[model samples]
Target: MPIVNVQMYSGKNQREKDILAVAIIEDVSKILSVSEEEVMILFTEAPHGK
Candidate 1:
């Protein structure tokens, strides 16, 4: 199993996240020669201002 951690600012909407997740999963799966189900995307978001 491959775990992909994505750290970013907490501002993206659900649709944006969905799009990004799909793209990452597709590319990662193809490059790693693994199934899409095996690729996991973890998003850690940081809020703006302290």
Candidate 2:
């Protein structure tokens, strides 16, 4: 199983997050020769103070 963790400023909407997750999973799956279901993606959203 491949685990992916992505952290960034909290700004994207649900659709964007879904798209990002799918893209990441696909890339990881292809690279690791594993199924998409075997990949785990974790997103950590954080606030950015200006």
Give the number of the best model, judged by TM-score.
2
**For model 2, how does the per-residue alpha-carbon lDDT over 11-48 read when each residue is reduced to its tens digit?**
99989999999999999999999999999999999998
- Score every model by TM-score: 0.92, 0.93
Q: Show how many residue pairs clash in every candidate, following the order shown.
A: 0, 0
Superposition error at 43 for model 2 (Å): 0.6
lDDT of 1: 0.96
lDDT of 2: 0.94
Residues 1-50, candidate 1: write the lDDT tens digits. 99999999999999999999999999999999999999999999998887
What RMSD does model 1 have? Answer: 1.2
Each prediction's RMSD to truth: 1.2, 0.6
Query: By TM-score, how accurate is candidate 2?
Result: 0.93
| lDDT (0 to 1) per candidate | 0.96, 0.94
